[model samples]
Target: MIRKIGVLSISLLCLAAITSCEKDFSEVGTNVVNNDKFETGEILLDVEITPKNIESVQADNINASISDYWLGVYNNPNAEKIEASIISQLGYISNLNNKDTDTTVFNLDKVILKIPYQATSTGTTDGVTRFKLDSILGNPDVATSIQVLENETYLNTLNPSDPSKRNTFFSDDEYLGDNVLSEGGIYQLKPKATDTTFIFDRVDRSSSLTGTTTYKDTIRAINSQKLKVPFLAIPLDITKMKTLFWDKFHSGEFLSKEAFDDYFRGIKIVATGSDGLLIPLNLASSPAPSVDFHYTISEVDGTTVKDTLQKKYSFPLAGVRNSHYKMTPATNSAPANNFVVQGTAGKMAKVKILGLDLSKSELTQQFKGDFNDNLNDYDIDDNGFLSLDELQKLFNYRKNILKSNSYLLMNDASLTFYINQAINNDSNIIPQQLFLYQNKENETGGISPTQLTDAYVDPTSFGGTLKKTDDNPEKYTFRITDYISKLLSGEENTTTDPLILKVYNPTDSPVNNNVLTTSVKSYNWNPRSVTLFNGNESANGTKRAVLKISYSKEK
Candidate 1:
């Protein structure tokens, strides 16, 4: 009886182990098997990469999509000369009480264009405060003439041809040949002693008891605080502005927003000379860039002055702020050492897989070269040619690779791009990240760039961030396991379209929990560049771009 009980216990233990190892292979369209019957390995594939220079990009400033507008010229020794200028439409101030009987006169004071610098205070000293400007790309001390001009072109909101679509503007669009508005002079990043002080009120509130159960009105104390802020106070031509803007206010041109826009189209701020002072301007900041119309209204009692009050009407530099880039192509047509990648209508690279579109027969022939031993399970007849039954089995096997079935499973697939340190050694100027998108052809025969399927599935996993190490090469690696699996399984058709690699923009991903339906419509304002190996090097070159894939297959 004791021997029989021990035998029964052993039988039940073996049955439990077998049941736990059973797998529902129907999920992956494969045969049922145990989990420990597969072998894991990795392979490296070749890819073709080519560099393409971008002449211009769609840089429309509609709805203030682009936050940062560049101003100044950047001259790089290895790359092109980039000239950036700002053309913006001014916002109108409505509801001005011109009919007030208390104010009978309007006298124009000095008009100044205030453009605030992106700076942070470096602590106070005695009674004065000092600040350092942020992201001054080139030499900040270099002098350059900044010209403010009246924009002659009327920036339309809607497209005239289609009406349903918004008007699109390019970085290379022309907005010159207008009357100069600024008091032309050489400008530098010199913080003035007089304009450094700013005054603001600091209010304190407290409660006082009036009765046993009720409290009196809150007691308040107001104190004025003075601090220093850095900004560019470019004086405009007072005479021209009075005739053009101030006089028009009384002439009923400022009655409506449309009337004002038609009369005064916009203003253009352009930097002259190749002094290499690229100022990053954020017009959307608080106390935005504007043309201040400082004036005074005098209250008179029958031609006798009663009281005088200083007033100001500010026309903000808002609505349709466009950045026009004038880029001069690099002199060297070919950089034999490395390929260049830049932002803001700059250079990019086109990437393509070498054998992504091979037919079943071709793929079988290629598989015979390296994975011939693994094909033994499918080719049951031991024939060189794959029959219909064998082809169906091969398709199922590849499909199961993505599902991690017992038959086969794809673990990872990635592409690593090594940086050319010989050229792009400056970490400050090197782009922090790179973006890759598919250049798909639309029905209108135009190429539209879109994010890859891998990005949509999981952007975190589809990495393109710059990876650095103490001993290894600085590189950008992208994992595209799903993309490769679809291609290998014939689930997705391989097209002639190639992947475009460009500088990363925040708009490349969805914002504010919005659905990512389209590619980036705004211009890439990041003015940085990097040089990378094209992967067409010799057979033994380690820096050559290649797709590395790791997978598990039936042994």
Candidate 2:
């Protein structure tokens, strides 16, 4: 009886060990799901794919009223002149009170145009930032002439049909003082360090230097104020413009701001040199851009005593001006079909997906190609729709597999974008970051500018890292798991508005807080971004943009 009991206990122990081993294997098998398969089961891993094409559009009058003060832009190295101009609107003129005294000689005093530079440079003893408009690939001390000409063009207030005429003033507008302000009379705007002790290269490449040979030290600040000095002090030849000013002022036109605007218009500064400088001024400050008129007034005091007294007048710059840019497309960008996006907010390259369709037949065909799995279990009809009954089969299969043995869930989902580097090899010109937003149109049927909250996904957090395979750089994949989930769960409000990928600049602001609601487009304060061709297109590349998904099943 004792031998029989011990044998029975041993048999029970063996059976229990076998059962435990089977359970462990079953759990392991449940955790393992085919990466490239849409197997029949209670939990199915499926993906919705959409291919898109890109379109390019130029925003109307984008450069009309910009924030930056454009010094000059040398589009073609071999070209004769730079395609940039600076115009200033005259504010209240204080010295215009004595318009009656015509005989009073208004001597040609020094006319200085004060422009404060933006803090594009940093790293000094005081740790303040400054910037200088210097050459990148030319002589630093090379003498450059800035011709101060009076703007005779009229700024129309009426709305026009043509976009080019929207600004009212054209680049080729009649600039007064062409002959009056001779080249010899114009002073050379030579760049110099405010601090004599600090030493650095005045002219150098931008921060986007790709190679080691080009980078240079940034300009240093002095006394916590390196850029405190006003940028350009080009003394205008008051002798030549004296007659124009005299005629306008004595005619009682300077009495009213509107009359002065029509009579004097504004001043235009044209830069002439081989090298160009990107000098943007802080127009939103004191000592603002202005013209000082110095004159002598003769007064007979009491008893025929003629006294010559020196009096001064000031004309502040009215806050209306813009920096114009003329860009010549490269050989690659010359193609008609090629999409292009550039500048801050000047232009935009668009990525548009056709309709979002995940029909039963469409799903089956797309899945068959993507999964590459022999779905022998699914009795799918070749011509008919993949009906609910067929889909239930897959679910039922998954359920049976997970019956008291395994578990599964989705792991990740993403959308990938591949950049065509070959399109633009110039590393310095490439955009630092890209933005995605819902491109909505306003009441005017124009693509409205995006606000800060409109950004859907950014590369810093959701964008893919640069991946290179062999010698070729691959695509940038962004995790759109939540976005895709919303679409699949029928929770996304994406029917009316589609997604658009644009070059994003975080520091973008309105030209003026007061005129923000006006028709004028905001300045492109952000960094430039690149134009990405559709990956699905054969002409650009074979790498197609895809919504990738991965999940597991319990069975």
Candidate 3:
């Protein structure tokens, strides 16, 4: 679906007389409605997201103040990078606008776009993130709805997290081996690699930029509950850092266990703000020089944004790594998904479950009207579990939707059930989701459950041998949409179909067999006894049935 991207928001606190110049990213209690004009005058440039590297591009269809612009991405296309100038060449800013608008007059190879991974498609999000990736990859002029984060945030200096000096989870811990060293906010490295491949490191015992005032920035988890602590995670692949951190200083020395532990526990990195964060200014490599504005809010006359924040980097001169680093404005869909899901799981169960992404399709609509309504619509609730009956019906309706198949036993710390209602039609209302699993207790944040024992079925509603053949193979995706939809709708039992299995194999002629009955997934909730579907007691030939999926780190 087409998503809105790249909406710039700035801080403009109107005090009595003097204009208050707010720091690069310090929020001084400003109203979003009152600052539209101010944001227009200011052009933000991210040096890290260069014209040569931008994978998603932006285009100006109609030039009007506050009028939404279109994003036009060109990967070797004729689209040009932003051309910034100090003073408006046409005597005013209008002249500069004229030149920028004219560049697309002749041969602007405009095409609809869809955002990929990076500003440059290399996979790393280290550069500028606020820019909309959808514009770079999707439709040329579709009104975007994104709030871009500022990259000009400045702070004092940075110093590495010394275990002895700090007290947070990332500080004061001894790391070991090639295994990802730090758990929550740390990593270990050895065997120095290229700066781009592994740039800043504590593994090789090196610091690129060193001075009294450090330039450090970070992505901190506010409320701590929102944290995806690296080490404690189930999927081991979350430890994405592979750049070796071998310290040649003692490369061949005894591989002493004691020293190894110390090296892991003692590495630190002191990065600075303002410098390391590269942003593009008005499409030009250069940015206007920054001045000390000391922007302040003497008073606020309107609504007090409640249950909320005023968090920032350490007081103009201190370090704020955990929850106070500068952040790029966003909520971009694709990149956000990249951070939450890995390719393996997505390829397995997500992207294909819905003949079209019900949520995304509503926004983009390109894949609409191409599905078999007979196929139970699939969905994955926020909790991540599929509906048993709906899933079975989907396969029956589109029985040939599999290239290969396998039953998953996900190892989870917790299981939950809930109900929700559809937003639009009273007749169209469906349950939100039926099942949810947590891989880790800590990662579960703190959800409260109403009941520990709930009865439900999980075997195939329409089943046979769930094995794949060489020819009748088609790729399939697994999604929990059915479960989520059921949970949200609060329509109990009505959505669940009894578990049953049947087989008709070609052996000279068609031979019928009642292979399995009772949903296997339902048995999983028991948390105790093992369920066996295909046994000698059954009158049919042996055919296996899977009860429930386990929740564990995918290998």
The candidate scoring highest on TM-score is 1
Q: Which candidate would rank higher by lDDT, 2 or 3?
A: 2
lDDT of each: 0.65, 0.43, 0.19
Model 1: lDDT of residue 481: 67
- In the range 79-150, model 2's lDDT, one tens digit per residue, is 112335566666756345554343433333334455544434534456544344432222344555567777
RMSD of 2: 15.3
TM-score of 3: 0.16
Tens digits of per-residue lDDT, candidate 3, 1-555, equal 111222211111011001222122222221121232222121111100001111211111111111111111111111111211011100001111101121111111111001111122223255422322211222223221221111212211222455333222111121222332223322111111111111111111012111133222222211123311111011111122111111122332214434323332221121122111111112110111111011111111233211211111111101121111112212222211111111100100111111111243331232133343522355644333334344344334332332122111111111111111111122111111122211112236742211111121232221222222343211111223234233222334322221111111121011125443211111100000011112111221212111221121111
Return the TM-score for each candidate structure.
Answer: 0.76, 0.54, 0.16
Cα lDDT of model 1 by residue, 1-555, tens digit: 001111111111112112223544322211223356644455566677888978787776774367678888777656666778889899989876534364265566567778776666677779667677666665646665678899988888888799898887788899755688886533443433234433222111111111123223211111123444566677778899988977667667888999988888898888766656777777877656788776656666555555556567788997777888887776554366467788888888998765433344545554443344565575443224444334445555543332222234456678888887767666666778888878888889998877677777777778888877764338888887666665554443434478888888766774337666656444688777777887664732778777776544455
Instruction: State the weakest 10-residue window (summed lDDT) of model 2.
Output: 1-10
Clashes of 2: 7
Q: How close is candidate 1 to the true structure, as a TM-score?
A: 0.76
Q: What would the C-alpha RMSD of candidate 1 be, to one decimal place?
A: 12.7
Root-mean-square deviation of every model: 12.7, 15.3, 32.6
Ranking by lDDT: 1, 2, 3
Q: On a 0 to 1 TM-score scale, where does candidate 2 land against the true structure?
A: 0.54
